[model samples]
Target chain A: MKPRVALKYLGLTPFAIYVVIFLAIPTILAVGTGLFTADGSFTTENLLGLFAPTVLGTFLSSFWVSAVTAIVGAIIGALVCYAMLGTRTEGALRSIVDSASSVLAQFGGVMLAFAFIAAIGNQGLITVWLQDAFGVNIFENGVWLYQVPGLLPVYLYFQVPLMVITFMPALQGLKPQWAEANATLGGTQLSYWVRIAIPVLAPSFLGSLLLLFANAFSSYATAAALISQGAQIVPLQIRSALVSETVLGRENMAGALALGMVVVMVVVMWGYSALQTRTSRWQR
Target chain B: MTKQTVAQRIGAEPGRITRWVILVVVGLVFAIPIVSMIEFSLSSNNGHGYTLDHWTGLLSPESARTYRTLFQGIGNSFLLAAVTVAIVLVVLLPTMILVHIQFPRLRRVLEFICIIPITVPAIVLVVGLAPVYGIVVRVFGGSIWTLAFAYGITVLPYAYRAIQANLDAVPVITLSEAARSLGASWPVILWRVLLPNLRRGVLAAAFISVAVVLGEFTIASLLNRVNLQTALLQAGQSDPWVAVIFALLALAFAFVLLLIIGRLGSVSRNRSAQ
Candidate 1:
């Protein structure tokens, strides 16, 4: 009532202007460019082309790898978080674990590939051990664990720690007294966790897994970096479409492929959100 | 009853055993790669014999040059993050203030806009930015500055989340109004009242910016910047030992940042409790 100037300043002046310019514009361009041909023609060709068996195989492989990683990560994270609970440790150990977790959590993509290579490549430290001690030949025999199965372990390098960091807080949030209460009622560790801990942790656990899934799905550089150039996930495919030298190759199709990836992401995220909303009710 | 007795026995023993087995397996999975890194770092390039060569190499004059190059990368990262944080603070603080002070109706919309970055993959952002950067650099005579602009957008998620969380924590309307009613100017209110209350958020934001800027790979890799990460990649390609050393160094850097953030968080919580 006192000053119309202040209201005008707050409503549409600075904040809205910045949002429309930087955030809105860039994001709009990303989506819109992905939906159209380079020459500006509208086409569903890119999206439709994803249905090719080779492309579909790439998507499925990545999906399967991510799902396996999520499950393995969740189990590992839950176990570590549970063990660390109610345990006394020196400050150094805690610091070390925390540091390890931090590095592992952020350890991803291309850089991660390099780390793994140094550890297990043909000239790698472990490669020598595997060859000499165990009479195993990774190079000649072509180990599945270092190829198709290899990607999962690499993904888990980040995923496991991610699972730990994400779940640690929620795991800690559960009342210690609740466990004690169950024990007093003559319930065993099994029954106590089954009845109490799992229920408490379900939301955080699911949410963390959803995040990991999305993260693994969108990841391009990790698979491309660790595995050979032949690896073909959706993000890698999209990347190739954008950057490939052959100009005649489908640039518009690439945009459409990128758009298709986003749409799949949206669907998965929406499904996860709806599931989260349903399961979160149990926490209360 | 009899049913209850059977259920209890089956449930208890298996669960405890399962938990222990699961913990050991997972722990090994996480621990093995790290062990491999250390093992590789400790051994010499020529043979499997133990040597402190890698650690010693990191301390030599040539090593100092590498560190200098790394530091330069760190410096560029700091500049990018600092500038981004400053710009975000300048933009976000008032927007936060306006939301609390004048236009509560638009707060949700504002918040949604801020969070849009989290979902946008860095690679996608880089590719989308290619045409823009080409135009900006070739046409407008800006090279790395355009990269910084892109980096600012990339880091928006981290800083925005921290600032937003801080904004949610403090008494925004009361502080702003109190400052305003006392004839304090907008900038003064923001600097004195708002910024002080936002110390924790600012610290968190700074930590996040440092972590993100230091470790960011996609954009820097795509653009082929001589940033530390890309340099490490180049070094790795040229020399495996150098790659191993850089990996160890990276681990050290990550650990230190996490420790600082952890301590800051604990300190802030203690202060708030007091």
Candidate 2:
């Protein structure tokens, strides 16, 4: 009613229109299409197809990759953060580490996959060097570099850095006074970490891990670049269903897979937010 | 204090040694793959010895044809990045300032909207964008640059948080009132005073937008647009060495860009403090 209030509302108009057009409508289409038939009548076949062995296998493998990367990344990244704790915050070493972590954490997709391939693929530098110098063969068993097992290490390249960035704040929130108090109370280092530090940091750690899992689960380009054939992950499956010329018409199937991914991500992110709030309480 | 001496005795010797070891080990693990990329890129395909062949081969006529797509992809991505950054700044900066100044209660809703993209995975976003893109193409004549509209959304969460941090650090109301009292119009207050103060945040947001655009693959590839990442992946199929070389160069470029932005951010912070 008032011009001042109307102007305030007007400030939000452009972004609201953009969001509704690009984000909100499309997302609704993705979820809504999954519940319908190709003829435009309502049907549950697309959703039901989600439980087929092939589709379910892709989901399981994706979950396995995400979970492994999340757990390992959390432990290693937290350790690195602890090591960082011993350094001066304003020191050159700390700044370099922080900056590198920030850049590398966001570094994924095609280039990242190529980097790993260059380092460890069949004709990679490391593989060739090992054969030349030591008569050892990395492919002695099989060429696993492009397989799901090999993806573990490649995923960690980004995941560990992400863990460092996310987990470092919680680590810094820990006050030295608590450690001093524990020592004064006749507690050993192990007991201090076990009884005090771990409990305080648990929510933050779990939150970071969940974030990492969601990140890895949703990633597509690296896997697509490395594994040329087969839809090994959910993302690849969606890609095949959408673009593979031979498949003809699986558009709704892609929608179904996307809906499944959305559900998982929504749950993971909600939990992450809850844990974030819990962690912030103690932090403040 | 007794606690001080005890902490010194307990943590001073072994703790320092253990900490350094962990730092060094972690650093090496992170650095090795990058080091290996450089080494592999330089080595001869026959494994005889190191050579500049891969670098020189990029100039060959055959390589030129192959590189056309890669170069085009790079150009398109750069253009998209620029447009996305421009759109984000134009749309978000004014809205953020207005909300902070006149309607603080709407801050939560703005934050919630921006953060929703993070929860919606890129693949799902692509799925949603597919049918919409069909209509967009039919209407807009299917230009590659239309991808910027989707990309602007993807960068929303990062750009919003960066600008919000800058906003949170300054007293927007106080600054505006002082300028108004000095007879400065809203445009002058925003452009001269607020914009300069928010330069660091703007730079950070722009850097992130560029990096994300360069690295993004899922949406572009799914939508049938040949962007940098997709082109590189396709190039890897025919000539792996050249592709790897480009990948290394792009990664280094992004790293340098981010490092420069970080330096600029801290320099501006120090200047303000002084």
In candidate 1 the C-alpha lDDT for residue A91 amounts to 55
Poorly placed runs, candidate 1 (over 4 Å):
A1-22, A87-99, A138-140, A143-148, A180-188, A245-248, A272-284, B1-29, B48-78, B138-140
Weakest ten-residue segment in model 2 chain A by summed lDDT: A242-251
Superposed model 2: Cα runs more than 4 Å off: A133-135, A245-251, B1-8, B11-14, B59-66, B264-274
Q: TM-scores, in order shown? A: 0.84, 0.94
Candidate 1 at B153: error in angstroms? Answer: 2.6
| CAPRI-style grade of the A/B interface in model 1 | acceptable
**All candidates: DockQ:** 0.32, 0.62
True contacts kept of 1: 0.26
On the 0 to 100 scale, the lDDT of residue B105 in model 2 is 93
lDDT of residue B175 for candidate 2: 95
Q: Global lDDT of each model?
A: 0.67, 0.85
